[model samples]
Target: MKSRWLVNLALLLVVAGIVAFLYLKPQEHEETDAVHEVSNLKLADFDRVSIEFPAKAPVVFEKKDGFWYLVQPYAARADQVTVQRIVSIVAAQSHEKLPADDPARFGLDNPRLKIKLNNEEFVFGLYNPVTSEQYVAYKDAVYLLSGLYSETASTQLLEMLDKNPLKPGEEIAGFDFSRLEQWQEVRLQLDKGEDGKWQVSVQNAKPSQDDINEWFDGYWTKIRALSVEPYTPDRRAGYPTFSLKLKDGKQVHFEKLQESPQLILGRPDEGMRYTFPADIGFTMLNPPVGLGK
Candidate 1:
C-alpha cells in the first residue's frame, strides 16, 4: 500500500510542474510583445516631405541632400531654418490623434501644404470649415487662422533677395546688401589720374572714418544674424565666383576660371583678385567656361 502511495505522489508533483511552466511562458511572451511594439515607432522615416502654400508656391525636401528646395513655379532653394522648424514640429506630434470638424483651428484651412509619406501624400487646406477664415499649412499639419498673407510677403522678399543682389552693374545678377556689417575694415585705394590716366592713393577708410562704414556695419550685423550658415560644396562646381555688396547698396560680381580664383572689381575695371576666406560665403553662378571641353 505504501509503495502505491509513493507512485501517486510522484505523478502529482510532475503534473504541478508542467502546469506552472505553462502559466509562466505566456507572461514572458506578453512582456516581449510590449517591448517590440514600442521599438517599431519611428519619426525620421517621414523626414522628407513637401509643403504647399496657397497663392504662393510649393517646397520639397530630399533626405539625401538634407536641404529644402522650391518645387512648383520654379526649382529654387528653400529657407533652411524654415524647413527645419516645420519638420521638428511635425515629427514631434506624429503620434497624436488629429481632431475632426474645425481642423482649421490647427492651421489646416486653405489646405495649401501637402506632405509626402512613404507611399502616400497628405494635403491640408487653409480655410475655416464653418467660418470664412484663412488657413495655413505647416509641416504635416494645418492651422486655421488669418494674417497668413502678411507673413508671406516678407518671406518671399527675403527669398528673392537671397538669390539676387542689388549691385550696380549687373542687371539680373545682384547681391543683397541687407547684411554688410560683418566684414572687418579693409583699406581702399584709388590711383590719381596722370593727365588722362589715373594714379593710386591710399586714404584713411576706417570704420570710424566714414558714415558709410557705420551704416554698412549695422546692415551686415542684421544680415549675418538672420542668415543661415553658408553651405560649403564638396568640389569646385565651376570657376570661382565673387560677389561684394558695398555700403552704398551696390554689388560687384566677378568670376575667373584660371587655376587660381580671382575677381576684378570697381569701374574702369580695377584688377582685384580676392582670395575667398573660408568664413566668407561663396556661391557658384554658372558652369565652367573653357576648360576640358
Candidate 2:
C-alpha cells in the first residue's frame, strides 16, 4: 500500500508540472497569425475618397486612366505625390482610442487640406481652439495646397526667359551713372573676341578669363532660381523703369506700361519682351509685391 500511494503522488506532481508549463509558454503562434491577417489587406479595397476643406471647397478624385484626376471645377492636373500620401494615411490602421460619443472630433475639421477617394471623400477643416478663428479652405487647391508649386515656379521662370533678347556675343549698351542710382551700377557688354570666344565686359575693366566664365555661369544659376509670387499691382508707380540703349544707338524708355513685372530686352526698336508671373526678377533688387507675407 505504501509503494502504491507514493506512485499516485508522483503522477499527480507530473500532471501539475505539465499544466504550469503550458500556461507559462509565450503565444508565438497567435502573434504570427495576427501579423498574417494585417498583411493580407488589399490596396484595391479603397477605390474612391473625398476630401473637403474648411470654408473653401471640396475636391473629388477618381482613379481613371491608371492615374488620379480632380473632377470638380473642370478636370485639372492632380499631384501624384499628394494622392499617394492621402491614400496611405487613409489605409493606415487606426490604433488610437476613439471618442465614445463623437468621432467627428477626429474626423476632417479645420484640415490643412482635404482629399477624396473614389466614393468617399476625406474632409479637412481647421479648428483654432485658441484664436476662435478658422480658415477652412485654401483658395487654389491644386496650386496652393499641392506640392506642384515648385514646378510652377520653374515654368514661370522659363517663360520669362522666352521674352529676353540677350545673346552670346550681343552687347547691351548703357553707361553706368553713379549719380543716378536708378539702375545697376555695372553695365554689361557682350562681344566676340578674335579667337571666336564669347566675352562679357563691364565698362573699361577687362574681365579675366576666369571672371568672364564665372559671370556667365552665375547668370544661368540666377535664371534657374527665379520664382514669382503675388504683388500689389498698384506699386508699379514706385518702380524706376530702365531705358534700354540698343547697339544700334537708339534709346527706348519704358514707363510702367503694365503693372505686371517683365524683362524688357533691347531698345524698343529692336528688343524682345518677357513677362514674369509676378514682379520678382533678377533685375528688381527689391521684390515689389508681398508674397503672402
Candidate 3:
C-alpha cells in the first residue's frame, strides 16, 4: 500500500512540474502574435531620401562623405538634424494597425504626401480623428501611425540647406563683389594670397591692402547671418544687384529690397533667397570698409 501511495505521489509531482512549465514559465524568448512594423526598416541602412509633395517636386537628400547633402533641383548642403529626425520617426514602430479594405476611406487613393526612403516608400493618407493618429500606406500594407510624417512632408527646399552663407569650417580664399551702378558694372574684390595675407582690389587697380581686420576688428574669423528670412527671387527681373563669389564657385547674389532697407540675398543657381538686416547687408556688400559689430 505504501509503495502504491509513493507511485501516485510521484505521478502527481511530475504532473505538477509539467503544468508549472506550461503555465508559469516566463515568455522571455517567445514573440507576441502581433506585428507593429511601420516600415520594417533600419534607418541606418538608408543612404538617400526623397520627400514628395503633391504641389512640389520631391527634394532628394543623400548621405555623402559622412554628411547629408541636397542632390535635387540644386546641389547644396543639408541639415543633418532635420534628416535624422524624419528617418527616426518613420522607422519607429506603428502605434496601431488597421484594416486596409477600403482605399477611399482613408485617402489611400490619392495620398497627399509620399516619402521614398531607399527601397521603401511611405504614402501618407488620412488622419484618424478619433485617435489623432495618421494612416500611411507602405507597399500594400496600411498602418495607423503618428502624424509626425507630415513634418517631413511640409519641409521646404531651402529649409534643407544650411542658413549661413558660409558653412562652418569653410574659409574663403577669395571674394569678388560686383553690382550694376547706373548701367555700368562696378567690381571690388579681395583675395587671399599663398602667404595667407589678404589683398583688396578695385576696378583697374592692383591689390592695395593686405589687412582686412581694419574693417570689423575680427569679423572674417567668422562670416554668418545674424538671422535669415526666406524670400523668393524674380529670376528674370534685372535690378541693381551684387554678387559675392566665394572660392568654391558658390556666390551670394543679392539686392536691396525696394520697400525696405533689408538686403535680399540670392543663390542664383539654387533659386533660393534670404534677407538680412541692412547693417549686416552693407557689411557683406562692402568688404574693404569697417564692419565692426
lDDT of 3 by residue, 70-181 (tens): 8886677677777887777556676567677777889988887888888678778899899888888876668877777676557766666666655545456665564545
Q: Decide which is better by lDDT, 1 or 2.
A: 2
lDDT, model 2, position 63:
64
lDDT of 1 by residue, 1-293 (tens): 99999999999999999999998776644443121111232446554655555665554554445545544444444555555544443233222233445655554444445545334444455445575544434334333333333233225423422232222233321232222222112222222122422221223322222333343334322322122112233235453444554444455644432322332111113222223222332222211111122
Estimate, for each residue in 1-293, the C-alpha lDDT of model 2 and write its tens digit.
99999999999999999999999987675433121111223456565545554554555555665555545433433444455555663333321222223324533333455554444333333343554332222221211122232222222222322223333233434322222233345433344355634444344454455654454445422332222222223333453455434456654443333434554222233222334434444433221111223
By summed lDDT, the worst window of 10 consecutive residues in model 2 runs over: 135-144
Q: Which candidate would rank higher by TM-score, 2 or 3?
A: 3
TM-score of 1: 0.32
The ten-residue window of minimal lDDT in model 1 covers 282-291
Worst 10 residues of 3 by lDDT: 284-293
The TM-score leader among the candidates is 3
Off by over 4 Å in 1: 1-47, 52-58, 61-67, 92-113, 117-120, 125-216, 224-293
TM-score rank order: 3, 1, 2
* Best-fitting candidate, scored by lDDT: 3
